[model samples]
Target: MIRSIIHDEMFLSVPSEKAGKEHLQTVQDLRDTLHSVRERCAGMAANMIGVNKNIIAVTMPFGEMVMINPVIIRKAEPYETEEGCLSLKGQRKTTRYRKITVRWQNENMEVMKADFSGFTAQVIQHEIDHCAGIVI
Candidate 1:
């Protein structure tokens, strides 16, 4: 289902819980919601749709990818940039890494890890921040 974008700062500030196999539906919802807003948004976290699960959907060059319980294991080369969120009023300045290595689960609940950089990496870092309850 395509869920509504949450704008409540208090709600968005609370950290999301780890996702499990049972949260598969939330993953689908994230994908659906992300696709629905693809024109203006490149990524979305589960909390953005009002679900407090550590799940995020990102639009890659090939297609949309969902990351469950994503964790940034390593990051390098930080730089400052501004970003806008569908759940927020305007863009905010923040520091982001040029490269990041993440460990997460796929839709099937299988573990996956990979390195990402440039814009893709920046988008992942932003979504992960949502999981951590950090608004930037």
Candidate 2:
């Protein structure tokens, strides 16, 4: 049986120095129980990616990042956008990279990299920032 994750817990704290550690743990926990966790984190099934939910519903699992230690390789123009988190009850304004390329260690501890743009870029940056212990 798959179960959803508790979304509210993620938004409960400010991303302190331990945000990266905490986010990593959260991702791991999700991966460990992904079936239910994904369902719970995802508010919409097969919906286009947007700022509707705090969780990023990746359309493709291939190269799906579980950022354990994510670092931005490049950054583009700053843009303000409407965003929402499962942890946060309503939508809020946030700034994110218009473009970003990042590298992170996977669960296997292998170095992996990706480049993202538009909404996908935003989601990755947002989640990675959570891992880095930063909040908007």
User: TM-score for all predictions?
Assistant: 0.98, 0.61
Worst 10 residues of 1 by lDDT: 55-64
lDDT of 2 by residue, 1-136 (tens): 2234334434433332322333444444444443344543422211011111122223234533345555779999898887775444677788888888877665565678888788777767666555443443
**Which residue runs does candidate 2 get wrong by more than 4 Å?**
1-28, 32-64
Compute the lDDT of residue 87 as modeled in candidate 2: 43
Best by lDDT: 1
Q: Which residue pairs clash in candidate 2? A: 3-36, 19-133, 20-131, 54-85
Q: If candidate 1 were superposed on the true structure by all CA atoms, what would the RMSD be?
A: 0.7
Model 1, 1-136: lDDT tens digits are: 9998999999999999999999999999999999999989999999999999999999987878999999999999999999998899889999999999999999888899999999999999999999999987
